[model samples]
Target: MEFGFARHMFVGALMCGAAAPALAQEANASGAATAASRADGGGIPDIVVTAQRRSQSLLSVPLAISALSDETLATKGISNSAALATAVPNLQVSSPYGSTQPNFSLRGISVANEFNANQASPVGVYIDDVYIAARTSHGMGLFDLDRVEVLRGPQGTLFGRNTTGGAINFITKGPKLKGTEGYLEAGYGNFDTFKVQGAVETTMVEDELGIRIAGNYEKGDGQFRNVAPGGRDPGGVDTWQGRASLRIRPGNGPLDIKIRAYAGQNRGTEAGIHGLEPFRTGLGFFEVNESRVGENQTDAWGVAANISLELSDAVTLTSITSYDGGKQNLQQSSDGAPIDVLNINWRSTFRQFSEEARLNYESDKLKLVGGVFYGWDRIVTDNSFYIGSVLAPGVDGGFFQHYRQTRRSYAAFLQGDYNLTDKLILTLGARYTADRGRYDDGYAYLFARSVTDPQTPIATTVPCAGAPGSCAYDPAAIFNLKGRNNALTGRVALSYTFDNGLLAYASYNRGYRSGAFNGGSYTSSSGINYVDPERVNAYELGLKGRALNNRMTFSAAGFYYDYTNQQVQDLRAGPVNILVNAPKAEVYGGEVEASLRIISALTLNASAGYLHARYKELALQGVNLAGNDLPFAPHWTAQAGIDWKIIDAGSDTVTFSPTINYFSRQYFSPFNSENAPGTGQINSELQQAGYAKVNASLIWVHDNLQLRGWINNAFNRKVYAYGLDLRGAGFPYNFLVPSTPRTYGVTARVSF
Candidate 1:
């Protein structure tokens, strides 16, 4: 994690970007069409995308999007959503607390605090057209997926709620109407890991009905062995999931229907933290010193239905309905030491239901899509914390909280593209959304200290019934709040496509994120229960094209955003953080992506992103942070890779792929202080250093069979993925979550 090493890697990536064309030239000098060339037919494969609500070639789409196919996922060892950060530019995903929750940021725009269930994310996440409402479930297994699409701009039209920072769509493999196919894959890796995945699809009634089934199971030992007395192991994966889908289409009819159901459960060790005690412990990376039993258990299930009807030769009507729910129970040590002074347990449940209908019309000169959506969500949570004698004398007690929240939303949108000429097009889109939220009967209490208690002691009544100030939480304390807001967002664009397959476009979009209540742990107090909505107006210009007769593909874009009433998370007191609205902010960035098929046997890919994000006007608690950089906003992010095919024949092929991802130094907190620990600093000196992760894989393919051996984090670099400053809580410690260590594994797969 040295600065010198990071600089070298960054320069190397730029060199790779410049050498792609030269490599293509050298490949042309050799006159033979190798077996690899014959396999690919001497051209880059066209990728189909649905970013614009329609099926089109990726090269013709006028947006900044990064998409990965199923094949690419397997070759790159991208097993979960967090790993996707390595493949996409200007995108970051992390688990600040544990593996159960995932936080995503696009272009330095993200939810500042993710600990509360009532907070809404600016980035939208969807699965099979159904918006995922719970942040905890965003880390679900990525099995049997057709594609993962990331749209990097404001998506206000023809999409669900809160897309101010863009959207991520997970498209799963659906049932086939005319064919039967399936695949089985199994793998063995480090930490005693064993995993299996299988998927099958068949046409039950020959072009009329079809069915598909998929399942996944993985289990392993903990990554970090516990060395503390009475400490439990952490970082183990024990989960299983299954999915079933059905497709019904009457013979040659214009109507089609799809039904899908899925369920998953996990019971394993929870996530732990490593405290940075440089002077005493000398950088503890993979170990946690805690005297508690860590447990992270969860259950999730959902169902969805999609109906499409062709009203005419040029028009179609579609209806989508979905229901999703998840439950979690987690317990972990919060002190990151063996003192047993602090521990947290959270039990929560979430459910959401949504319905959407859209009308689409396509013709030679015009394309139009309009939609209306309605959604309802509910959450119930019970959180408690334990305090021991080590932290406070005769103050050993637990704080218990219970709350319920419900939200209802309605939205309508319209978008159209009109071709003014054969190569010129004009696009216009708009959406209007209204949201209503309510926090029902809620209460909390703190129990009296018990000297002989081995665990948190629960009391039936509040210990401080009349004197509420003596206890952290009280049953007499009650909160019933409601909030409502409405917004109108839109987009406009102009585009032109040349006859030689080059497309360029310029666009402006306005998007908004809904207002929310601080209804969870921090709402028991007065005057800080609600925060205003956030809005962003973004401008983007982009170019996408193919050169060398479709052998090389490139995309580039520049963007700027104006933000208002931005929601910022801040800590007011011990264990009480509130979301506040900032006056204004500005962010600007650019990105470039390129892929060159140097030869039939060799291909090169590289991408880089630059960002300059700062707070134009922000004041909290009499402290001005107008000139500070946003949290987790890195100046540069780059990735480079090379794919080589050693042998390609009718029945056999061998290939190797190596990739490296680099990220510049980034501040984990907005305070951006670089002082020594215990210096009464608001922001700990701990920052995520610039680092690189090297990954490689080798594959052997024979007709319908394949074998892959891969290594991730090949150098076993001690990189920090997440960090938290806890100086305000009387503990001068910075907890760090390290990246996974080097892991090598072998996977075998077969297709029929």
Candidate 2:
């Protein structure tokens, strides 16, 4: 059957549906009255998510769900999902292009390179049932969202075929009727940042059809100072987005359909994170006139459709199918510094295609779910150039090259839980997938050709670009290789619910990440050397509960991961680039979360996490990198916040919140044998210092009119977290990517 909308009735059938808020249960004085065995929103809606590729409640799924409410997002300075990783437990995010593009990871299992959009992210990010495909795909996806759910664990059950580590799903707001409502917000902050966003929704046919549309635009200056010739000045990132959606519910039937379309673009500087020098057991000292490099321009868009139908009193059938895709072409200079220094330049472009189709049937006794998924990605060109011989900086040698990779994947799964009794439940799921991909590498250079004298030859050099012995003039050189791999994955879970709203569960799951050949120096030739996919077997225990009559909720989980034949970055004997598969490894971590409402208008929330990710064993042709700390993995993180309101307000309500976030120190450059001397890694910085950030915001609401102001990183602390230097020309301390600094802005919003 065609899972996508039917040709003849798709549009018409969708315009006849109605949205009804969740049917709330009656409550008693002690707060028990607020317990929601189900959601309390418009229409008796089902929480549809591929958490395990099934439609289930946000509370009962044995796994952990770190959900951020739409109401909460607006109150805080959180404007995008990428900024959420650090706020969520055990979840971490990193970006190359800018803060807008984030690569997500859970319990510290992130894939090293995301240059290939179609390849897989250790953690999958999806929107409205459609899998996002470009490396730069969902960077601007934070606007006009309903809620965001971050699911942590090896999701081998049901989802996009390539979710090996975890998954994040962004659910947008649907059509709401009975009231013509929408809001417009405009603000100006640090770096001369200017932003505007607005939305509107009204009933077109009373209780039958409804439509809503929203749009946003944000621009700011380059934050860092780049004084180099051909180098861009700091503080320049501009972005914007637009979205439209429609809802239809058939009369006298348990059916509803929602369709949405969205588009966004980004154009700015792509400053690679700056690197740092080892502390050398000394105090902090500084330098003047540092800069960053490169320029980036991107465009992305997609569409999604969801259909829900109740077949009977005990069964409901839901189908969600969507086609989503995008592309990004970016050029950047890596580690160039000290204004006017001719340095290394790199360029990359990616295009991706993804699709997912699933069928879900739910009943009081048991839930049956199954689905099929596939995705394709092509990283057509990845080029990096060095202005001089890398090791011997003064030698006049230059080289440029490109690498191409294509990753294709397919998967099938069956999952659900069967209730044995009112308090006991059994959950199980299985998945199998076939994955294949290839890597192509090549490079060309312009430099002095070196040779040994024919007799007692001291090294002699010519200016020929070809024939290895002459420098008079010649051009180019190439290298090649090929690789292929396939694998199967699965998961199982069990949980028990108490008389109260508390649940406990245990699960064992599998995760897989496809591997690829290395293109060190960006010049290796084409090869199928797509290394074998890495696999993980995880064991976990979790607890989920609702207290104070559902006014307060708490959830926690801990897990241990065992990996076989792990795929990791390996520096070759000569520092030339390449990736390899290791024999085995063990990684572990845990996360905790809690949310509570102290009073009708006051609430408190906090989350803390810890992870110990290391290489259990490593070998490069038999030499070992065992016990090495995994790069970029932080050991500890915490986030907490509180909300307060002013009462006795006539038609006017005021709310304020202050938040704190922290991350422990993490290593960026390898300090172990996993990376020996010659590989480009040796000179790389050792570790990125951990730091804390504090932010607060104020909001006033007065019927159709709202005002908000915020200041982030209030102390103006300079973070060494993402030091990126385009002006230092191999200078130390480059991982210098800056979080917004003491930014403050006010926005006026109106709704009609």
lDDT of 1 at 389: 55
Candidate 1 clash figure, as a count = 0
Error of 2 at 6 (Å): 54
lDDT of 2 at 324: 54
TM-score of each: 0.92, 0.82
User: lDDT by residue for model 2 over 1-752, one digit each (tens)?
Assistant: 22121211222211211100010111212213322342241111123444555545666678878777666676667776667764687676666556645667677677543233334676777786566756577566466777888888777777675566777888887786455778777888777888998888876766667899989898877665544444565436688888898888766358878888888887766643443333212312212133445566677777777777777765555666565555565655444344322344444455556655556667787887777767776665544343433425454444444556677778888787888897788877787887767655443333332111111211112111223223322233334445566667777778987655467899998888766555443322221135677788999998765554455556667789897655455433222334667667677877767665667677777777777888777765245667766655677777778887865388898888888876776654334323333323332444556676888888888977888888777777766434222222232334345444467888887877
lDDT of 1 at 454: 47
Q: Write the residue-wise lDDT of candidate 1 on 179-214 in tens digits.
A: 899999999999898999999999989878999999
What is the C-alpha local distance difference test score of candidate 2? 0.61
Each prediction's number of clashing residue pairs: 0, 72
| Clashing residue pairs for model 1 | none
The prediction achieving the highest TM-score against the true structure is 1
